[model samples]
Target: MAASQKPDNVAAVMKVFAILEGLAAQPSIGLSELSQRSLTSKSTAYRFLQTMKELGYVSQEEESEKYALTFKLFELGGAALEHVELIPLANVEMRKLSEQTHEAIHLGALDEDSQHIVYLHKYDSQFNLCMNSRVGRRSPVYSTSMGKTLLAWMDDNRAQEILAKTHFIARTRYTLTSAQQVLDELPGIRQEGVAEDREEAELGVRCLSVPVFDRFGQAIAALSLSFPVVRYEEQKRDEYMALLFDAGKRISSGLGFYDYPFSRS
Candidate 1:
């Protein structure tokens, strides 16, 4: 075994983390002091620092030959925090929507690949025959109301790219099974400020969704209400849409988007 290498490379990993922590503690530090603080050799620390610098997690000052933590780590942390913050901020409005309708309420966001919508938070319907779903569940983007709402608000080129990559499997007879069919609906969805799934993803289940925007006015998530078709009333659609739109606006405002484009009137 190499002197600097530990069993299964654990020591190397620890040394890297230790150096990171040391750099975090100091505004800037020299190679000698950093290696000593991290309990690693100067050569090992230099190699790790060079790797981290290349990865954008650390920066080196040319004049002083000192290493400092970079904002890349902070930016990653901020993104994670923002996602975490979204749940609580959205839950408040979700709870209100649940109380108002006693129906299933879901908060969904685009999955990492932009090919699906993942449920992040959900409030089950009070009724026994309501839609069944859980957090972390994923559904195809072309067939779900939440998915359409997300796609509708996205930039045209990006939305087109995602649509092009989608596998339009027909989950139900009503599912849009082609890119053109899905694309044709986006304009109306954007105009109405809501999207609908008329038993497209699952039989007897209908969903209505509104876009939730971020600080940049980009849609970050979709707030949706689901109901059994038996309980869904054509006349009451507007009433439910109002509730969802209100909730979407509130959650978006919490995320720093005040210019919610949808109006109930």
Candidate 2:
């Protein structure tokens, strides 16, 4: 067997990982020094470096013949960190909403591939009859308040691209059945810093949502409150909106975004 593939194939894996660690320890590295640090043959180190470069994890300085780590690793790490940070921050606010309103509370994020808002965390209403949803369940973007809130904060073209891919199945008579219908409402929703689903996704359920922002001030998720039509009071709309906005602001602030656009109640 080739030396690079020796030691039950673990040595080659360890060698490449060592090379990555060595590359990370400095801005850039030459093949000879990287090989020396990783304790691998120059040939093996070069092969692994070439593979990492092709995979977009490493870049080479043409003039100096040195290899450097790329932003790709940072991008992956940032995505992981965003999810990790979002849930705990959201949980704190979600618990508060649950106690205050005794209504279904949800934290949702966009799933572009599915063209839906995925419930990331949720608190069931205290009542026996309430909105039916759970964590990991997906809902149509064009009809759900959390979905609309997420899209409203996104770039117009990107939001349109996602809308174009959506199947737009009408889950209820009130559901908006076209992309243009949903698109037209996004501007107003964004302007108000909130969105609503008035019996759109379900017959008896109404929902209100506010955007959750990240450190970059980008809306990365949405927080929502759900009420049954029989239990909902028109006069309490403002009260529910206030609760959602308060939770959203605290969650966003915890995520490093201090300027949550809406006024507090």
Candidate 3:
């Protein structure tokens, strides 16, 4: 417990991760290029690639001998989509909350590439929020409730790094104009464990959301409820905020993750 693991003993795992990462960065790659890029010896690269192929994480093109990722990676991700796991749990709860409040519910995760909210699930509200976003759509994190909840939990430096290259697209009059304003709101968001979007993403939409944290206190995803601003009047903001937070916590607990403010991992 007191000693660091020896390098040679963990080299195999490290090599595999490097290979996977290299493959991930490229659309498709030949073995020679992969071996060179990953800096692993050809034999070692081929051995690990063969292992990954068997496991269905990598596949070789029959036409060109190039390697690409396979749906087996999705199979691995599917482990996290279990009903008691994060994705499935969020999906079901979002539907339940949408039915209960008659407001659209959504789940989003922070994408490493754009720091945008990558949509996962969207529950239709009976009252119709009029949003047409679907799964796999990307929205600016600066103005979206999903983005704000996850960003509100990030550390100052980490958040700045993400938003630095980020272009603050003004989707509406209510969209946040600068990173400083976003940084300022984080403290209060951290205190309350919830974030609100008042017509930030659109002219008439209002969103209330809370982050879904893992057992390690990392915000891997977020849960949100959206409705028309006319429906979620200022008088009801606090009440609706409470309901969304409760739903967020329930899903977190249901996933076996204790709800806490997200740690900047």
**How do the residues 139-253 of candidate 1 rate in per-residue lDDT, one tens digit apiece?**
9999999999989998888999999988788898999999889889999999999899999999999999999988989898999999999999999989998898888888889
Q: What lDDT does the true structure give each of the candidates?
A: 0.92, 0.90, 0.78
How far in Å is the alpha carbon of 87 misplaced in model 2? 1.6
Model 3 weakest 10-residue run by lDDT: 256-265
Give lDDT: candidate 1, residue 193.
Answer: 95
Across 1-265, the per-residue lDDT of candidate 3 in tens digits comes to 3124547658778778889888988889998999988878889999999998997799999999999888777765664564236767777677768767888888888774747888878887786345667888888888987888888777778888887878787888888988888878888888877788888888888788888876656677888888776777678667767667766777777766775543322
* Tens digits of lDDT, candidate 2, 1-265: 7765579568778888899999999999999999999998899999999999999999999999999999999997987789888999899999999999999999998874738889999999999999889898988888899999988998999889988988878889999998899999999998887899999999999999999999999998999999999999989888888888888999999989999888665
Model 1, position 239, has a per-residue lDDT of 92
Between candidates 2 and 3, the one scoring higher on TM-score is: 2
Please count the clashing residue pairs in each candidate, in the order shown.
0, 0, 0
List candidate 3 stretches off by more than 4 Å: 1-84, 261-265
Estimate the overall C-alpha local distance difference test score of candidate 1: 0.92
Who wins the lDDT comparison? 1
Q: Of the candidates numbered 1 and 3, which has the greater lDDT value? A: 1
For residue 244, give model 3's deviation from the true position in Å.
1.3
Flag regions of model 1 displaced more than 4 Å.
1-16, 27-70
